[model samples]
Target chain A: MIKLLSLIFLILLLIVGKKRGFKTFITFYLSIFLIMMYLTFMKTGLNAIFLAIIICLLATLVTLFILNGSNVKTKSSFISIVFVLLLVTIITVFIGNSANIQGFSLESIESIGYYSHDINYDMTNVIIGMYLICTIGTIIDTSISISSAMYEVHENNPQLNKKELFVSGMNVGKDILSTTINTLYFALISSFIGFFMWFYSVSFDFLSVSKSFDQNIIQLLLSFIASIMIIPITSYISSIMIMKNKK
Target chain B: MKKYLTLKNILIFVISLTIILFVYNDYFLYKTPILKINNIETTVEGYGSYNEKYYNQKITGVIKNGNLKGKIITVNNVTSTSGVNDEQIHKRSELFIKQSNNNIYSIIGVKRDKYIAILAVLFIDLIILVSGIQGVKTLLSLFVNIIISALAIFVFQSNADRLNLLLLYIFVSMIFIITSLFITNGNKTKTYSAIISSIVSLLVSFGLSYLIINIHGRDVTIWTMDYIEYVRDYENYFYVCILLSGLGAIMDISITISSSLNELIDKNFKITKKALLKSGREISKDIIGTMSNVMLYTCFTPIVPLAFLAIKNNMPLMRAINYYGEIELIIVLCSCISIVLAIPISLYISTYILKKYKKEVVK
Candidate 1:
């Protein structure tokens, strides 16, 4: 049943892609399929992580190229975003791995220890790898956004100086801050609503819940805070790079 | 601005007093079994005390509602473990009560729903104060979205066929995307473009995930851990989760792209198709990275603590990743896939549809 449903879904995507025209549909389907392939074939932690990084970067490049093909401004911004992403990924891994936030096992693990125990691998590396995989998408998204908006501002007022362009980028960043934060927070919270329900079902009081805020919640909070913190950094870098290229 | 006390202030004061009185009267003097603090070590055996590490408190409270109203009860309130700080119950805290045969009630745990509600109220208030009417509309849209989601879940749960659930979800999500976009932007062209791009992107990602799950057939048993047996019975719930996980980020990106494109078209009616396409690309390049970050981080948040747990337990990274981290990994992957598609999806639809329609509508 699951396989049949999946096949149907695949066919639908093809139809939609076909109807929409080849450029949009081909990359749209290919990018997703390639990522899925990497995830399927790569069992080792490091292999999967490296492949994911490559896949994400490729997707960013392809999408940006298709949307704005060989545009210097877009390409430069993409490079800047990639540089910032590399930096952020290192920082996140270093901080996250050593933070000791992984000390507490999730409640789900307590019951199904069998599944995880069967694998003989460096789970720590995998955890870090997963963090990198998760963190990269947002970093790419943020840098691209800041750069594009700044480019638009420059286009609108060709005479606007570098400093003015930088300021304009900051303004765009400010307008998006709240909604971005809300989307991030809401997405996490909504997914964990069931997890929260479990805690409540167990009669864990506020203080108890707080006490049990544990590794998972802490890690989540840290990841989000770190991601949000990167927005300004990426925005700043992208704006500066775009401004320099304007001349 | 008079110095004298106003009606709102007086009313707040009265409500405060009433709450204080209620807590004191109901939790204290009127109840038979009363909670008393212990400065020394004490342990209460059975279901709540198996951990042996938590500081157990003997709690006493009267049944304030239901058939066993006014009946006093005493039970061990176990402190939840693993949090950075200890969780303690307070006067305003609500507890889940279970009644035994002899009219005795078990104070299972603290009711967290109320606290969550209180926090949400505070969050909404802050938004309203800062953004004014815009915040209210955002808040209303959020509430409606929640209601609609709950309705979707109810409908899905009542039905048995997995295919129906999937189809229902697609239909429901279509409604969701349209309604949410309409509420947030209210411009038909932008809304239409956003809805189309979002759904298309969602379909592609969801399809890929379904493919991954079917072909590999890896150990998804981690999802069925703890007390979540329902996932085992209803596999489609997992797909539902995958589908909805990135909806917000995808919608946000599509809307941001479409709306920005609409603005560009409005700015220059005489702009050529090539320039317009370039502008659309420019817009996407700026937004896609940040928007993708939003999606990735949301999925990554849950994994942080799980990693911490594995580290602390002396569990190897491989084992932990296999069991605890798989779901988080898949969610991130699904979201990234959707986000990648959203950029082009939004760009093409917005450029093609908005440009074609703009000359006629003159908006």
Candidate 2:
């Protein structure tokens, strides 16, 4: 099934995106391989959070620079994304440690329950690493969108001041904000639907269900927070960089 | 710095900080007993059968809720540095406690809702502060969509045995597309075009996936799915997941294309259909990679830890992929396909609706 779907996806990408489609296909696989390597490296007992940060930077470079090419937009996007990534990492570590949702949920335990959890690495750091990696994609997407759109706006209206450009970027960010949030919300919900159904099937009450769902909810909320923070910050930074380039 | 000191920004920050501070300290609000750990004494460290290290801690804390308010209790906690199955109980952390026989209390879990609440407050305040009115509407649409989804889940929970869950999801998907687009974009030609294009694209993509799945037949592994024991019909549930997962990206693409094309048309009334199509393709081409990347990461990232665990347990790569990675790959690939397919479908639909229809009405 995976093979057939990938073939179809490749065909569709070729038909619609053509060269860029092929590029996306490669980047997608490259990211997967990168993640696989990150996981393998994590087993060596190096600092998981630090390794995750490096992997995130590498992944961002691959996604933004490779896919979009090294242009002004990509550069500014890269800068803002790194800024946001670092900022979000601090919050991730703090919240992740306090929340202590590092291990598998009771729902997932049924499948992998037989396996040994003695992987010799801190699950808390590993889970925090996952959060950091998970958020980089959307952060890159949001930053690039804002930067590219702001670049266009500045090019079209060279007379627009920095404030005007910043406002325009905000307008664009506002336009995409809802849909972006929707994308994140649905993706998170769908991934965990099985757990939700299980919660329902077993007839767990609301409190217990919410308790069990805390782990997933925290992840979703963190992603949302990251993307939201990226918007204004990217818009402001891109506007400043674009205008500064004009001078 | 002066620009950053706007009244609204100051208000948002102050309000959010106040909320965070209040939530962090308001443990009395909970009916369940909360234990504030004052001391943790590590009692033991040993190796398990797999040579895994573990630690045992004796924690002393004071209860902050229910009849045991302000009463100190001691509980035993076993943990490991890995913190899987058990976590190192930090001093000064609050936990939920349950009373066992002989009136002894055991820690249930950490009280982390205060942190979640703080984050939620920050997220909401930032959205409103940055995006202003659109932020409010976006949140409103989110609230509506969340309620609708909850209702859909409830419907599925009750009717899992009797109903066609896919059909229910299709209906819910429509409501989702309509409510979200309408609330966000308001009542406009662009919104209508987006709604039409998204629905058409969803149906077409879902049909393609269904055909592919059918052709692939029943040899696929469904048992590797989490919580599979509770699912009644694995095929239907799988389809539901594929559809719901792809819906957001599909809608996002369609709306973006339709709105951009509409903006193009609105700016240049004499633009040719060929030019419009070219522009739509250009816009979607730029978006498709990142959008699919979003799908890929969102779907694949959650399973990384599980894959790590499988590898750590010495499961073979192929067997591990067979276990869970295959499912995530399929979900992501199908979503990518839908997102890729949505580009052309939405372009054609929007051009016809926004261009040809407007021309016909003008004539």
Candidate 3:
């Protein structure tokens, strides 16, 4: 039933894409296959990883057809790449068929293990979901919009030097940066406000409490630092990438 | 430094901070104390002393309709926890409660180097002030996303059923995308293009992630981290959830970068389709540069605590924190796979958005 709904959703999404003038029907189809294939075939080991990468690259080229269905230029190299990936994947699957696929067992039911008991992880994930779904996603979207403004500035006036366009992009990025970062920080705060309460409620001595996890307050401090670190990094990366095209 | 300041920027910072502070104050700082001694009923002899007011507080409580209605007392000392230095100590003292039984619980705060707030303010101020209208749109979208997340836990996502958990995430995700894209692009053909592109990119990442994890021997239950504690023990929901979670951000980034590039090319008739596609691919390589790390940093946030424990115990990096601790492994692999998938997803979506947009203009 889940599968049926997802399939229907995919179909509906594709039809909508068509109606809206965005191509990608076939790529969309391949993605569905990829999801199923992964659930069925892949593992996280090196070999499984290699297999998945092959499938993804091959599938992406096929997406070109989705974008411009028929009567479109087909890059020969792209086709060849897909063919080779398929060939390799088939061979690997045959060779690596020894992986045990056990039927659902009552034993598998008895001891479901570790995470089934972690309170911290549960609460953290709710926040993480918010971060991923909203905060990070928002920043990225704004980055794109900033990039658009830059792209427009450059394209409309090719005379604008690379530096000017870069500046323009930066300008737009700067516009989004403040609220975007605010949103990010606030999201972090709200997510872990409990941790703060835990921190303070027991006399600001985070040392003993800190010792309880593989990660501690220091790590939280660092990761939050890292989150801050991404702001400049993303901005700079986009700016530099655009600058390279000009040179 | 000064470039980040302005009334509008300051206003944004001040507003958000003020709101955060008010909420923090009411929730964490505000206090109401109600104290009671085990056998100390109403004082008979000190009734006159209670009226002689050294009390610093106004206290009110009532025994409802039955009999204690409108029983009110104006107080001085709360529950007598306060020390009395009086040589002529009042024979009877006003009694008060330190905290009421049902009143909200509150806690003291940690003192940080004050620099943190300044940095955050500057950072936020810079974003809202610089982005102008777009900044506001992004900010509003962030709030909406929070609401969506809040609902995901209580209203939608149930770790009890792995399948429902997955669907719930996907549904919430769609709502998030629709909200942000609509806000950022406004109502137009372009917004529609961005939406289609965004969805396609997400699907691409999802596909590749699915392939990698299954091929790699990841246990579905492994992804739920520590589920039995929070939701239910048998929940295999997170195996799918974390991957989907990672996919959303990566997908969002890819579509965004690609669409912006497409818009650039569209504005310039000279930028041919091949050039545009090449540009998207090239830009993706650059996005991959840091984005891969972003994924790592993202994974680090939760598992960082685990890593800290490992380090303090002098655990070897591998065995110390158990990098592949089933849950962390799920996150690490999921984010990594999603990061890798993001590249092609962005490329494919951008190509489609631009080409299709071109076709529509012609039609």
Candidate 4:
């Protein structure tokens, strides 16, 4: 029954894509298949995080190519986003370790073993893995947006100096920054309403809950802070690189 | 604007009153101390100790709601093994009660809904102050999403045997997409583009996720998360979680792409179709980074700290990765996949629709 439903949904997706043209329909279909193939074929091992990152990057590459064609400028922006993600991933690991925010805290759940009890899950690596995986999408998204904005600005006024073009890129980045942060914040807050409810229901006073510094809350704070921090990095990098390429 | 000020002031006043009442209720609102605190203090000092704890505070209060109203009750306000205070009961706190023969009532647990509601209100107030009218609409949509989700859960609980849960989720996802986009955007070309793009992106991501789950899913079983054992159909819970998690981020990206495309098209009607398509792709590049980052951070919020805990426990890297990283990896990947795919999906759909619209205008 589930299989039939899914097949029906896929058919609907294809039908929708067909209206746009064969390129739209085919690329859309292939994108879905490509991602699914990565998920199925990848080995679940110590390097699983890296594997997932690479697959996601590949998917993004394919996506960018499909939408924008194989432009040198687009490729450069993609590289820049991946570079930033690597840097951010390193920083996230450092923060995660020093903060000691791992494991199922007594606050969030009754047990620590989400997997089999006999298995000793490498939770530190898991933190690193999750961080890296989560970071890729945002980094890729931000890089593309900044790069795109810079290109558009340059296209509109071809005579603008590199410095001026860089400024325009910054301006576009600024506009995108505020809204993106709120989207992250609100989405995070809303998704975990049930968790908050649990805390309050257990009669955890505001002070206690805030002060406890549980892994769950720390995770949110870390993700929230790290995500916001990446914006300027990607924006500036993409802005400078795109502007410099203009010369 | 002045009327808005009055409304804002009233909200502030109400919030202040609640805080005051909360403090008063915990301390001096009702002076007759029906329940006394059995303050038992204990201290255990050393490495890995539970904070050299002290003082278990047991307080008794009268039942103020339901059939047991006006009954005296005894409840633990705090349970501490060392000098540290573990938890505190507040004035607006609600409790579950058990009735014994002699009017002696035992507090079962704290009722959490009221407190959650209060926190939710605080969140709503903040949104209003920050975004104004749009914030209110966001809040309404949020309320609707919550209602629909809650109803779905209720349905799931009541009729797990009767329904194909996956279909129900797909249905709910459609409602969520339509209601969320329409409320925020009204009926516009941009809104339709966002809705179609988001749904298509979601389906692709979910389809891929479904395939991944079937092949490499044994290690990351449903047992790893909370609320599974009690669920009859615990197997589908993870998929449901993935589906729900991606919705906000996917919708967000689609909306960003569509809005940008619409703005660009409106500004440059004379631009060629090729340029428009190229520009749409460029706009997606701008959106993909921050939007994806928003998604990553949202998923990372709770999991990062848990990673830290494993480190503290001296859990080996490979083992920790195997146990914790595996499951979290699947989740992050699935959600991120949706977000990444959403960019192009939105770009292509918007480009095609806007091109058609432009040609129509020319005729």
Q: Which fraction of the native contacts appears in each prediction?
A: 0.10, 0.63, 0.02, 0.08
Comparing to the true complex, what docking class would candidate 1 get? incorrect
Docking class of 2: medium
The estimated TM-scores of all candidates read 0.60, 0.94, 0.50, 0.59
lDDT of 1 at B141: 67
Q: Is candidate 2 or candidate 4 better by TM-score?
A: 2
Cα deviation of B299, candidate 1, in Å: 1.7
TM-score of chain A of each: 0.72, 0.94, 0.40, 0.72
Segments of candidate 4 deviating more than 4 angstroms: A1-110, A113-247, B1-55, B58-119, B304-311, B358-363
Compute DockQ for each candidate against the true complex: 0.10, 0.62, 0.03, 0.08
Q: Kindly list the per-residue Cα lDDT of model 1 for residues B18-68, writing each as its tens digit.
A: 554554344333222333222223453333222324457566665655455
Worst 10 residues of 2 chain B by lDDT: B354-363
For model 3, what is the alpha-carbon lDDT of residue A157? 87
Per-residue lDDT of B343 in model 2:
91
Report every candidate's CA lDDT. 0.54, 0.83, 0.40, 0.54
Sliding window of 10 residues with minimal summed lDDT for model 3 chain B: B80-89
Give the TM-score (0 to 1) of chain B in model 1. 0.78
Best by TM-score: 2
Q: What is the lDDT of residue B352 in candidate 1?
A: 79
Report the C-alpha lDDT of model 4 over A90-133, residue by residue, as the tens digit: 65566454433333334445444442221123344444555555
